[model samples]
Target: MFKEFKNFIMTGNVIDLAVAVILAGAVGLVVNGFVSDIMMPIVGHFAGGLDFADMKIVLDEAVVAADGTVTKPENAVMYGKWVNAIINLITVGFVLFMIVKAYNKTKTPPAPAAPAGPSDNDLLTEIRDLLKK
Candidate 1:
């Protein structure tokens, strides 16, 4: 069992999967940062300082007692955060698409197939020429 596990872990597919997972995680972080730090600010500025991260529908207002000993937390739907997440998803998808497109452009196409063997017509023609000679 130990040997089987070791072999499984050493397989090319497993290694490739591990690398892909790591790369995906790193890309996720970069995309998240780009959306939150860069894109959101620009979007907010264009929308007259509309901050999606702060958008929410309050369901219940918080109540604070005079003595500050009893309090109820606010209940709200954080739609702004959801909007940000959607934007992040879209950006990551677009970025990955562009990357794949660029990478495909650099790949060498498969070599053209070798010319087919002489056709029957050509063979017959060659025979006819030889006979005439």
Candidate 2:
């Protein structure tokens, strides 16, 4: 059982999958940074300095007591964050699509099949000549 487990862990497919998962995580972080740091700022600039992450709908206001000791936190729906997330998702998808398209362009096509051999008529002619000789 231990050997079987070891063999399973050592398989090429398993290693490749592990590497792919790690790479995907790294790529996700990079994409997230791109969206948050670069794209969101540009979007905000174009939208008249509107910050998407701060867009929210307040459902209930917070309650504060005289000493400010007894209080309730504000309840709100954060729709701006959702919008930012959607933009991030779109950007990541488009980038991945472009990457796959470029990769396909670089791939070499399969070699053409070998041409067919002599036809039946040609074979018959050769046989007839051999018989005559």
Candidate 3:
């Protein structure tokens, strides 16, 4: 059982999957950073410097006591963050699509199979012709 488990873990498919998972995680982080840092700023600049992350709908205002500090936090719907996430998702998808496209372009196509040999009847006919010669 232990040997079987070891063999399973050492299989090419499992190793490939593990490597792919790690690469995907790294790609996700890079995409997230690109979206949050680079893309969002450019978009914000074009849209009059509006920050998407801060955009929200306040369902309930914060409650304040006699002190200046708020007694309760504000209840709100963070639609801006959702928009940001959507943008990030789209960017990641586009990046992956481009990667697949490039990989496909670099991939070598399979060679065509060789033609099959002549049939039994054809071979027998050729043999008969040679005997006559």
Candidate 2, run of 10 with poorest lDDT: 61-70
Most lDDT-accurate candidate: 3
- CA shift of 6, model 3, Å: 2.1
For each candidate in the order shown, give its overall lDDT on alpha carbons.
Answer: 0.96, 0.94, 0.98
**Winning candidate number (TM-score):** 3
Clashes per candidate, residues 3 or more apart or on different chains: 0, 0, 0
- Model 1 is weakest, by summed lDDT over 10 consecutive residues, at 61-70
Q: For residues 15-118, write the lDDT of model 2, one tens digit per residue.
A: 99999899878888999999999999999999999999999999998888999864898899999999999999998898888988999999999999999999
Backbone clashes in model 2: 0
Stretches of model 3 off by over 4 angstroms after superposition: 119-133
| Colliding residue pairs in candidate 2 | none
Query: Per-residue CA lDDT of candidate 1, range 28-48, in tens?
Result: 999999999999999999999
Q: Better model by TM-score, 1 or 2? A: 1
Q: For candidate 3, write residues 1-133 as lDDT tens digits.
A: 9999999999999999999999999999999999999999999999999999999999999999887899999999999999999999999999999999999999999898889899999999999999999
Whole-model alpha-carbon lDDT for candidate 1: 0.96
Measured over all alpha carbons after superposition, the RMSD of each candidate to the real structure, in angstroms, is 4.1, 3.5, 2.6
